[model samples]
Target: MRFKSYWRTTVVAAIFLHFFVCLGLALALPLLDFEGAPIAAQEMEVVDLSEGDDGNADTEKPEPPEVKPPAPEPPAPEKPEPEPEELVLPVEMSPTEAAELDETVAEMQKQEEEAKKRGEDGKDVRPPAPPNQEVGTIISSGMTPDTRGTDFRGTVGVLVDVDAQGKIVGVFLSRKSGRFVVDQIVLNALKTFKFEPALDMNGNPMKTKRLINFPFDGSGPHPFDDDENKRMRAKRELFLRERQQQGNAPAN
Candidate 1:
């Protein structure tokens, strides 16, 4: 009986030890320090951000700005003040006076119609000529440059005459030369020119043309007729008389 008790005790002790050791190991394992576990990856659904067919997002959009209220219309402008009515004198209408007024108005209308017709037809009218105040002509002095080296010089005058018709009726040199070439040149030069008709004392239209003179200097060809020689001699005698008078006068 003693030996059987001892074996039973030993087996019980072994089982108890084994149970306590397991318990202690479980508790110690909890106390041991270890690194923290890695974080777990979470699953998220992917979404595309492309524009929709409607060109607007499926979600509600933000509200738009509110429109401002329109300004009140301005009051209509005040009507302009009525003009004061003119006072009219009451008079009995006379047949004779009415007839005279109608005749005067008709005459005025006829004159206006005639003027219009003339203007449209471009006729029965003439432009007023430019005013002529008689600008003097250029007269050549009796001097020739020695460079022209001529034996004689001729004096010529352009006699311009104005007519009542305001036309250039005549243009001739008071003294004529047989030289056709020189005469023609002088005539042609004058012909090319035009002048505004001068006004007479009565302010009526009068034709006027310029007269130019080329004084005979002691150069160029001296083609003089008998009449011209006589006139020249007379001019010389007059010049001599003037000179003698001047010589007799006392010096001022």
Candidate 2:
């Protein structure tokens, strides 16, 4: 009986020890699971951070290109000024040349004075020829002689002196017509005569003298015919008779 009781006690002690070991094992298993899970999560977060860093590096902006400065411009060239022209002077004159110039000037002045004297003396120099009438032509223009009004009828002669310019210078009666009126008519006609200028041996004009004769009485192609003269003479006689009769009549 005692041996059997001791064996029962040993068995109960082994059972209680086994029960405590199992409870301890259960609590240790929970702690190990929690610690292992946290370690794995920390490794995953580290990989994701490494990938994000690579992506940010690709999206970053690039640096700007370096600018090159332009080259400096060259300075402009300067213009040159024009040079002055050279001057040339003539040689001085010799003593002989100076003397010749003085002589030439004196000769020129003397020549000028002589020319002036000749011009002054030329005014009084006369032409070498006398004046004459044109050939085959007489100066009978502007003369109308009327012998019918008077009883006196005669021939008249005149002498005329003409100048170098064909102008009448002087007139003289060489023969009288017996009547004063007839003489006056001849004188006036002679004064109006024009002539051609006569030339001397040198072919230069000069003054000249000439003589002319005129007749009245309807003779030798005279200006008045015989019939007209008779008619005028009869009229004049009648006028004279009337005047005499009037004079002889007694005053009223």
Question: Which candidate achieves the best TM-score against the true structure?
Answer: 2
Clash pairs, candidate 1, are 152-219, 152-220, 153-219, 153-220
Cα-lDDT of candidate 1: 0.49
Deviation from native of the Cα of residue 118 in model 1, angstroms? 54
Q: Local error of candidate 1 at 242, Å?
A: 38
Candidate number achieving the greatest lDDT relative to the actual structure: 2
Clashes of 2: 6
Per-residue CA lDDT of model 2 for 1-252, tens digit only, reads 344357678899999999999999998887775545444444444434453356565586666799899888897887787663222211456889656744644544444345335355475222221234212112323243545655666766555566676666655555677778878766654443455544443344567554455666753323422332243345445645666788799999
What are the per-residue Cα lDDT tens digits for candidate 1 across 146-199?
213433357455555655543456554544455655555455544433333444
RMSD for all candidates, in order, please: 31.0, 45.2
The number of residue pairs in model 1 that clash at the backbone is: 4
lDDT of 1 at 219: 44
